[model samples]
Target: MVQEIDKLTDNVNDIKSLFRTLNETLESIEKRLSRLEKMDSIEHRVEVNQIDLSDIKESLQRIEETHSNEIQHINRRLDSHLVKIAKIEEEMIIIKSR
Candidate 1:
């Protein structure tokens, strides 16, 4: 009877050790899952920021294009006005001589 009791006690101790190992493994898995969740959140925020930056770049490019076009138009108008003034001055000189 004593031998049987010793065997039972050994089996109980083995079961307890197995339980402890399983609990440790579960805790490790939980920590890893938490870390993954945090990484995912950070990645999502980075993606959103990237999209916002891209939109800002596109808006700046459009503004630059508009300003360039406006400058070219203004330069053309100035050139046209200068040419008209020169022609008017020549006409005045001829009239004054007569």
Candidate 2:
């Protein structure tokens, strides 16, 4: 009878050890899953940020093009005025000689 009791006790201890190992494994899996979830959230935010930056870059490029066009227009107007002034100066000199 004593031998039978010893065998049962050993079986119970083995079962307890198995239960402890299983619990530890479950806890480790939960921790890994939480880390993966956080990584996914971070990746999504990065993608969103990249999209926003692209939009901003496109807007800035458009503004730069508009400013360049305006500058060209002003330069053309200044050139026209300079030509008129030169013509007027030549006419004044011709009249003085006559």
Candidate 3:
């Protein structure tokens, strides 16, 4: 009976040790889960920022295209006005010579 008691005591100690190892594994898993949650939050923010950046780039391109067209129109008008001024100067010279 004494030997049987000793065997039971040894089994209890083994079970306790197993429980301790299980607890440690659970704690490590909890830490890893927390880190993954934080990483997911950061990744979500990066995705949102990427969308915003694309929107800004599209808006800037539209603004540049509009301004480029306006500049071309203004240049055409200026060229026509310069030609008219030259014609008037030539007419004035002809009148003076007469």
Candidate 4:
């Protein structure tokens, strides 16, 4: 009977050891999964930032184009005014000579 009890005790100890090993393995797996989740989140944020930057760049280009077009229009108007002034100056000189 003592021998049987000894055998049972040994079997229980073995089972406990197995349980400990399984718990350790599960903990390790949990830690790895958490790290992977964090990495995925960081990657997603980076992608979003890149997209926002692209939109900003496009908007800036459009603004620059609008400003450039406005400057050209102003220059044309100035040129037209200059021509009219030159013609008036010529007419005044003729009248003065008369």
Candidate 5:
């Protein structure tokens, strides 16, 4: 009977050790799951930022095109004014010669 009691005690100790190992494994798995959730959140934010950057780029392109068109219009006006000034100078020269 004493030997049987020693065998039961040994079995209890083995079961306790197994339980400790199982608990440790579960804790490790939970930590991994938490890290994955955080990573997914960061990835979602990155995607949103990329979309915002794309919109900003399009707006800048539109502004650049508008500025280019305005510059072209100003150049045309300047050319017209230069032509008129030359014609006036030519007329003055002709009158002075007379």
Candidate 6:
């Protein structure tokens, strides 16, 4: 009877050991799944940033075009002012001669 009790105890211990191992395996799997979920989130953010960068590039191009046109217009105005100054200088010189 004592030997039979010992055998039953051994069986119970074996079952407990198997349960612990299974629990550890399940925990490892959960950790791996968490890492995969985090990676997916990072990938989503990267994709969103790529789209935003493209939009920013387009906006910058438009700004450059607008500034270029403004600069051209200013240059033309400056040229006109310079011509007016030259005409006034010529008139002043003639008046001084008299």
lDDT of 3 by residue, 1-98 (tens): 99999999999999999999999999999999999999999999999999999999999999999999999999999999999999999999999999
Clashing pairs in 4: none
Q: Which candidate, 1 or 5, has the higher TM-score? A: 5
Error of 6 at 90 (Å): 2.0
Models 1 onward score TM values of 0.69, 0.69, 0.73, 0.80, 0.70, 0.62
Question: What number of clashing residue pairs does each candidate have, in the order they appear?
Answer: 0, 0, 0, 0, 0, 0
Model 2: lowest-lDDT 10 consecutive positions: 67-76
Task: Give the per-residue lDDT of model 1 (tens digit) for 1-98.
Answer: 99999999999999999999999999999999999999999999999999999999999999999999999999999999999999999999999999
How far out, in Å, is residue 72 in model 3? 0.9
Angstrom error of the Cα, residue 84, model 6: value is 1.8
lDDT of 4: 0.99
Which segments of candidate 1 are over 4 A away from where they belong?
Answer: 1-12
Give the whole-model CA lDDT for all candidates, comma-separated: 0.99, 0.99, 0.99, 0.99, 0.98, 0.98
> Candidate 4's residue-wise lDDT over 1-98, tens digit each?
99999999999999999999999999999999999999999999999999999999999999999999999999999999999999999999999999
Off by over 4 Å in 2: 1-19
- Candidate 4 lands at a TM-score of 0.80
- Candidate 2 lDDT over 1-98, as tens digits, reads 99999999999999999999999999999999999999999999999999999999999999999999999999999999999999999999999999
Which model, 3 or 6, shows the larger lDDT?
3
Model 3: lDDT to the true structure: 0.99
